[model samples]
Target: MSTSLDTTRLLAALENVAVISTTDLQGNITYANDLFCKLTGYAREELIGQPHSIVRHPAVPKAVYKDMWDTIKAGDIWTGIIPNVGKGGGVYVVDTTVQPLRDAAGNIDSYISIRRVINDLMQNFEAVEFSKETFDEYYAN
Candidate 1:
């Protein structure tokens, strides 16, 4: 296949299957894929120009956010299992990877996050109500 065709196919596939969002350097949403919007139960309009934290779940600790910011701000990739709250307050889990997108001048312009739904991988079926206590107990080993 030609390079253009390959690029087209890759984008189509990513659009269909990947939960994707891009945030500006300050963390305002710049773009959101359909899958992301559907998963978060928010429209693209509601997401754009808003902070990416609009979907942040209470169960996530501040330390995690600090770590993620530190990693991505340094032009490194950050990967984690993130639990997000939807428009109606339902919670969902995703295996997420975040990386910086650089401009032509080699300066980091924005961050792109790609995620996969991991609901089936969760042991507890009641993850919608997942809280800090539940998270601690689940990981207590």
Candidate 2:
């Protein structure tokens, strides 16, 4: 018989602590925790096998994700704060990291993104100014 420390429980534990969901190369959701569902307003069935971009918010500058994709595709870890729109059209923020998973041949086979809800610190004027300066430098604004 299997113990409580089975694969499912381990995954559940990871979900309990993880802030976001994990996806495959096709952007299909493979694992999503309760926090993810709550944050995105998406049910498990609605998210699994669905593209992660479904939660992309219009307010978010596309350049951010462009950088993220470039980094992850290069087999690097991407860390940033992302703006996402919920199913109800409500806006939210998350401090996110996208890490690439490699297969036996050391080829990237998937991506795992961990994210945690962040307060709207950008709503502050100073934060906005800092963001403008930083992003301007990053994207040559």
Quick one: best lDDT, which candidate?
1
lDDT tens readout by residue for model 1, 46-75? 999999999999879999999999999999
Worst 10 residues of 2 by lDDT: 116-125
| CA lDDT, every model vs. true structure | 0.92, 0.84
Worst 10 residues of 1 by lDDT: 123-132
Q: What's model 1's lDDT at 29?
A: 99
Q: Evaluate residue 32 in candidate 2 and report its C-alpha lDDT on the 0 to 100 scale.
A: 77
Please give, for residues 1-141, the per-residue lDDT of candidate 2 as tens digits: 755588878877877766667889877888877888987788988998988998998878888888988999999999998788889988888889999999999999999999877655656879878888999999984
TM-score of each: 0.83, 0.73
For model 2 the local lDDT of residue 13 reads 83
Top TM-score prediction, candidate number = 1
